[model samples]
Target: MARFNHNKHHSSTTKLVFLISCAGLLGAALIADFLWASSSSAAPAYLSIASSWALEKSGILVVQNVTHNIAHHKREDVKDRKERIPERFLPATFADLPAPELQWEEMPSAPVPRLDGAAIQIKNLLYVFAGYGTLDYVHSHVDIYNFTSNTWGGRFDMPKEMGHSHLGVVTDGRYIYVVSGQYGPQCRGPTARTFVLDTETKKWRSMLPLPAPRYAPATQLWRGRLHVMGGSKENRHTPGLEHWSIAVKDGKALEKQWRTETPIPRGGPHRACVVVNDQLFVIGGQEGDFMAKPGSPIFKCSRRLEVVYADVYMLDDEKKWKVLPPMPKPNSHIECAWVIVNNSIIITGGTTEKHPVNKRMILVGEVFKFHLDSLTWSVIGKLPFRVKTTLAGFWDGWLYFTSGQRDRGPDNPQPRKVIGDMWRTKLRL
Candidate 1:
């Protein structure tokens, strides 16, 4: 029943071949359309290709392999593009920045040479209070420095009754509180007078006096109260253990009588007192003090009897004094030579113990950092020269100090060069 029809067979074969060609062209057109759609829209390349293949009923394995190859090539292209970009044009982070260099700059000198003075910074103005000037005379005027102008603004008279040296000074931004100190030159007896100065009005007002006068008391303001503790008593050689507080608000004493608190474990003067996070810290002082000749006129004093100590103490929330790690060495005459930076306290320029071999007074020149969190101390840097009674301040990441007594030489027993030269250094952390 096989009939030989060559023409019919050829026609059927040609039709079959034509159908195969059309199917191949249709698959190619589908791929082209999907690629164009992916380029012009947000649809993913692999997703577009998969949709096109699903409609064509292509092999699942073939679709996956081709899509994976395309994805791989796209990843490579992105990597190449990133490599073409410059590093500086990219976004930066704090870690990428360089550390600040430690460089010191000398600024305009203060109006008058001062030692044992008190300085407080309010906004852009620095107010320097009474201190020992040239020829052992007391400076009764307040010197001001305008940081914006880099020049001494002028001088204003301090209260005539205000003590000239060994004053306990503190500030609450707008007001400066001056506590008990030696009323005049040499080793004069301490005064019980307390004064407050309104920096805005440039006026001084007397407050309720201290129960007992003190020399270089460790004074600070904390928890709406003015605290005074640890200083030389009426007998300049005796260290007082008395601790007192007065309720104060808006620069005025809210209470009449000074209330007694727990006395400091180590009672002495010339200590750095600071209030941080509601905690009070007392650092560095001496047991004995410079005393005047029994009946000498001008009350000439001798420093030979003093015994410097590196003791540190802190008053806690429970109002109990807790002993802290002492300084690297004995330091004194640094009542105002400390500044808080971040979680650390930076101290510079103070009087240390006398030289062991020569028995000469040694001045501290190293800048010290005390980390409150770690309870550790580190020598961060050195000062241009050894000094004491330096008034330290911090502003805009810079540490500054103005007036102090500079060391004459390593062998000199006493610091005879009092300076008003100001110096500042940039700080990082």
Candidate 2:
């Protein structure tokens, strides 16, 4: 019963140790396979829970950590390979390409052929007001165009006393404000009478008259105030430097008297006035204007030697006029030819400096963009033909211009033809 064999006992112990080692290796192999499979796809919920618990209890988390490290290294290797590839082999992306060419489409023409008319767009309707029509007649009727239907809806008569040309028109969505302008044709003396029209009711109400009459004045609404700036005087030849404003709400003036503000640096008429980011900007105008014959009974106006300027001035929150970068070229007759697109003000057709050789009026056909952020100017594109006094409107990413004096052709320098034809182009920017 007490017989002790050293060799036999040693052999039994060795066999037990070998079996234990084999079992440990087998368990490790199973864990490695499970880890690999789990990494590729989701494991069963119960299996995941059991494995987590077993790892914690058996202190085998180091194995899982090692497996995770190997997978991380493999991912790093793939990323490194991608990074080493040359960029020239990659396919070109849309952002790397140039913008597509813009195409223009012809739309229905306006009922009346006019120039220097004020166009204000309200929703789908474009209201074209008093302009110089055929035979030098000032149109007193308002033409309503439904852009959705691409047709002229109808016409309505303006107030009998309302001025016909050089009228500074601005709309506050519901009401259309018509400021000082020549009451009749042939550069007649301007009228101080100011009128506001209720677009919904198609009725006109008289507002406080301007302190002084102005022809083609730069007028715009800013911060609940109606601002009326430089324009031609009663003689129609002198540029008024006076800047005036009156507190206005809805279509009526709140103050009894017009308040005088800082005068514009350079006074002129037919300038493009716009309010952007609470700032008022005046761009591209002429210093001189057409003058009336001294002894004429009807006071017929005659074209005077005028100088067009590219100067740009801005009135900021400080209420001080700051000189901005001038336009790329001298421009005028842009009273109603400008539209705001994003951060830039795009001006369509307008008058530029006269030709140096022939001294004939030069019309601008290229669309000009004034970036508000950068305070820079750029030539974006050109109109089908050169034009001046163009009434411009923007809606649904489309830029529309109608009723302007158009040039004969691309080679022609004179813009003698007044067109009622409407044209529109999709604006990418």
Candidate 3:
């Protein structure tokens, strides 16, 4: 009986050694499978069924052997992995939602012809103030679109022509504020002019000027103050992060104050900015003179790409700038087409570098909706028209944008013709 037992033990040892050898060979194949799967080289050929089965068998073997031999080690590895990840790496917005499900509805038209100005939404009314039109400079032109009525009407013209305004218009739920629009002989340049129009009075009053001149920047309401971001100054490029705050009485501007807050790390003209829950987001604009430092001539279009930044930036509660993941592709010339839906942002069409470079710029009608929580972007349906450098607003489950310039440029030797067309979009999510 002792002899038989000894032989049996030896046989069992031999079987164990043979299994270990097979496991090692399978492990090598498994490693090769992972490497090949993750390769960035030219696309790899599809794995054969036999090879796939072999890989699966090897994975099972490895997992089973590790589970049996190093259960404690696996537990420690998971713990270490959890500890190593930064909190920010986890989903921040919408608690890591996948994508936003939203719908859009179209609006009728804006009452007047305005371009390169600013837009603000108050209650059921959208007030577009002080923009250029078929005429070179028309300041003090205020057009109001009523959401409830699907109509447009307001003070048609101001005393002065406001030209090349920063589009830095904002609202406090009542009056619409227009600040630092260009006027006078330098209608095409920046101006320190500012104004506020009372919805009740339907009249415009000159308010304090901006500390510096700005043209076609972005403005929003945050922390009970109207915050403006990004635009150009007179004869100088302003990729500004300088934040200005204006005090408002129940959405009515009563006084103004300016603060040179953190400048945008990356700045450009015609960028689109919007705020969601007090967090400011800036996206899509022409990268002008951003590379220029003091004493150096600005390089306007150096690092040109077909599309540039699909990335979105967030200025969170900490007042620190965080680079969220970028969009799938970079786009520019996105005016104010940014709108919020289901806590996410919808970024519509803008001119790509291909457009300006090839002189084939179109008013893009495509929409890219970004999910704040999931850090993902999905391409929604396209708009009916190619709208760029236009004013867009969201109200009553619909989007309204108007007064963008569309032109036959160097192609026809004809100067750019500013468009006075208004478009409404309805998203079906």
TM-score of 2: 0.75
| Superposed model 1: Cα runs more than 4 Å off | 1-102, 410-414
> lDDT of model 1 at residue 173?
84
What are the models' TM-scores? 0.74, 0.75, 0.62
**What lDDT does the true structure give each of the candidates?**
0.80, 0.81, 0.58
Comparison by lDDT, 2 against 3, better one: 2
Task: Itemize residue pairs with steric clashes in candidate 2.
Answer: none
Q: What is the C-alpha lDDT profile of model 3 across 315-417, one tens digit per residue?
A: 8887777887775455665656677778778766555433321434434445677887887877776555445556766777776667766544321211255
Best by TM-score: 2
Tens-digit lDDT track of model 2 for 173-198? 99999998888877678899999989
Local lDDT at 10 for model 3 = 100
Clashing pairs in 1: none
lDDT of 1: 0.80
